[model samples]
Target: MIGLVLAAGAGRRLRPYTDTLPKALVPVDGDTTVLDLTLGNFAEVGLTEVAIVVGYRKEAVYARKEALEAKYGLKITLVDNDKAEEWNNAYSLWCARDVLKRGVILANGDTVHPVSVEKTLLAARGKGQKIILALDTVKNLADEEMKVITQDGKGVQRITKLMDPATATGEYIGVTLIEPEAAEELADALKTTFERDPDLYYEDGYQELVNRGFTVDVEPIGEVTWVEIDNHEDLAKGREIACQY
Candidate 1:
């Protein structure tokens, strides 16, 4: 399996830092960047080949690609997202569908988390599940969180930010395991999702798959520490989480 990262967004909420670099390159623990941690986690989980979807300020990623590869001992492939500044991540993820068919453990580049989360997803991949989402059932979720509602104790029924937090079973952490068999379906779903609305989040793509017959299962990472870096508050939380790791 390959490691995939969607690092395409401009993250305009983060001003000065994002002005020169992509959010993935933002530092949490001094010299260690969000991409650094993500690559390290993926390498720890035995996925040494990683594909990063890059868009706004992609030149920064290109400049540091070699250095990052040498540091993490990971073979990095860059997937360009032309609509990154204009469109959302559904299209960004869809850009990688061609190469990720072997299987993939995808993580959002702006998220800071321990390697244990990657380990959890790798362990759950053994269940022969087609698509598995790493869910944080223990987190205190709000409306901004990408929430998920499951069908009974099994598959994901819905995943979106618009859903009522009260009805959500848990938050879908920015990590997902897509087996080889499900990659094409996911790509198709993403196409449909982007076609419906260019501004849809990638979670909507997962919802499209759920709308079809695909059973996207959830693997709960109970009480684990992680933070998705979006705004200044989230970046602070990410630093805190990274310090623990």
Candidate 2:
């Protein structure tokens, strides 16, 4: 399976640090940047082939990729999305059309997780499901987190990025595994939505698939730590989590 790391965001929320550098290149601990930690996680998971989608300061991300490959003999492909400023993560995925196929694992570059993510991807492979989303039942979910509404504990009823915390049932932690058929379904869903409305967000595409009776299993990732770094607070938390690893 191929791994796709979405690192193309402008990261406007990350201010000064992102003003001159990509969010993925921002240093977290001493020598390692947030992107290094992310790629390290993939390496631990035995994922040798990786495709990174870069946009803002694309050169920096690509430079890091080159350094990592030279240092560790790692294999990472860079997919540049020139239109990243015009769209969202969905567009990044679209840029990776050649790589995102059956048994593909797409991860966010801003998050650092333990090595078990590879196991999560493998577990979701034979379930015969279209989409498998990693869910973590944690107490720190905010309104901005992706929330999942599941039915019968196996199928996702809905996925909402904006919702009242009190009404949120669970969190959809950004990691996802999709079968080949599901990728086609997702592509079709995205195309249909874009044809109808150009400004539709990517989650709407997944929601469309869910509405079509496609099975979206919420695979629980218990005790396996993952950190999402969007701001200073997240950076602190990510550092703390990395210390444990």
Candidate 3:
């Protein structure tokens, strides 16, 4: 499987940093960027081939592509998302549909997490599940978190930010393992998701999968230090936790 990163979003809240670079390019640990950590984690997990979906100041990534490849010792491919500034990540993810056929360990570009999370997902592979999400059961869920609901034995029943936090089982930590067998259906679902509402998140696409009878399982990454950088506050927290990793 290859490493897939969805880095196409325009983080308007992160003004100065995101003005010239995409959110993933924002440095968290000295000179090491979020994308750098992601690539390093993928390489550590034996996924030497990586694909990144780029937009919203994608030139920054292009400028560093060769350096990133050499530093990570991995082959990198870029997938373009033209609507990155106008639409949400459901379309950004769908833009990488061709790469998904190879199966992928997908990491959200703006998240900072340790290699153990990748290791955990890899360890849980081949368990008869097509789509596996990394859930943080320890974190206290809020309305801002992308929450999950699971049935007793049926895996994930719903994933949405709009859901009541009190009813959630855990929070999806912006990491997922998508098996090759699930690519076509997932791509189709993502297409439907974005076509229906350009503002919907890729998590909505996962909801679409569940609505179509797909079993989206979850692997709890027990008490991990991680952050999804959205605004300045998140970036500050990301920098603090990134060094620990």
- In terms of lDDT, which candidate is strongest? 3
- Which lDDT value does model 1 have at 137? 91
lDDT of 1 by residue, 1-245 (tens): 98999999999998889999899999999988899998998888777799999999999999999999999899999999999999999999999998669789899988888898888887886766898899999988887899999986569998999988989999998999888999889999999999999999889999899888788999999889888889999999988888777
Question: Worst ten-residue run, lDDT, model 3?
Answer: 149-158
State the displacement of the C-alpha of residue 39, model 3, in Å, after optimal TM-score superposition.
0.5
lDDT of 1 at 237: 90
lDDT of 2 by residue, 1-245 (tens): 76777888877777888897777777777777767776776677777778888998898876666788765456888999887777766667767767767356778778777768657766666657767777886646777788877888558877877777666667776778776777777877766665666556556677878888777777778777777788888878888877666
Best by TM-score: 3
| Global lDDT of model 2 | 0.74
Write candidate 3's Cα lDDT for 161-195 as tens digits. Answer: 98999999999999999999999999999999999
The Cα error of candidate 1 at residue 136, in Å, is: 0.4
Judge candidate 2 at residue 41 and give its lDDT: 69
Error of 1 at 216 (Å): 0.4
lDDT scores of the candidates, listed in order: 0.90, 0.74, 0.94
Decreasing lDDT order of the candidates: 3, 1, 2
Please identify model 3 stretches exceeding 4 Å from their true place.
none
Query: What TM-score would each prediction reach against the true structure?
Result: 0.98, 0.90, 0.99
